[model samples]
Target: MEDQRIVNNEDYAVVLIDGVCHLCQGLTQFIIRRDPAGAFRFASLQSEIGQELLRQGGFDGESTETMILIENGKYYTRSTGALRIARRLRFPWSLSYALILIPPVLRNLVYRWVAKNRYRWFGRSNECMVPTPEIRRRFLS
Candidate 1:
């Protein structure tokens, strides 16, 4: 599975997230629910593939506590990452892309505030999220 995840970079989008973060895990699940076209692939930041991707993108894996979107060889982080994912989701949820109009500094201010206290506010999981068998193939970790 790890080998499969390490293939040559392609056109698909990959989401890299903190494996034990409850909020991040929940956001992954939310994306799965809304990504009916299977437009995304996922990996925990702790996974080998996740680490490799971050390295290739020149990002510090340990320092990236927020969700990350890797698309067409570019990486998007913080609120930008979230909005990119949201724009690809189905139906009404894609409407969330409208929030992109807000200044990135303002958006990231709120994002960083939530992220700083995410573990205390949303808690953590001892293990990474386990996708249902039907959707397990979509996850790389």
Candidate 2:
């Protein structure tokens, strides 16, 4: 197991995703690609660091269907997390934040559907993603 790594309450955001889900890995890569400024760190939802962040945010840390964003001691989940993270990205991606005006119930319905089918549709990794040497520091252990 990776060590129990902890993220500090800094300006940087921390994202938690299902480690084995292909869609999640792709999303993480997309974030890294779009955010050249290195504004976020990442951990698997099954990781100790991810659990700690969930607990700190008052969530039970068992649900893995939702993306999570931890920033400045606050946490956002589901569509909110997705949109908030998008707001930090570049170009057309940042435009996604405008969707926040949509009702969350409708948005989360779509999110949950995609999340539920992700592994089936996109496959899964046997283990968490291994960040490349240059980006390794942006991933929590």
Model number with the top TM-score: 2
lDDT agreement with native, every candidate: 0.84, 0.86
Candidate 1, residue 94: how far the Cα is off, in Å? 1.0
**Candidate 2's residue-wise lDDT over 54-132, tens digit each?**
7776778786888888877677889999999999999999999999999999999999899889989999989988889
Candidate 2 error regions (>4 Å) = 1-8
**Per-residue lDDT value at 116 in model 2:** 86
Candidate 1 ranges beyond 4 A from true positions: 1-11
Give the C-alpha lDDT of model 1: 0.84
Q: How far is candidate 1 from the true structure (C-alpha RMSD, Å)?
A: 2.5
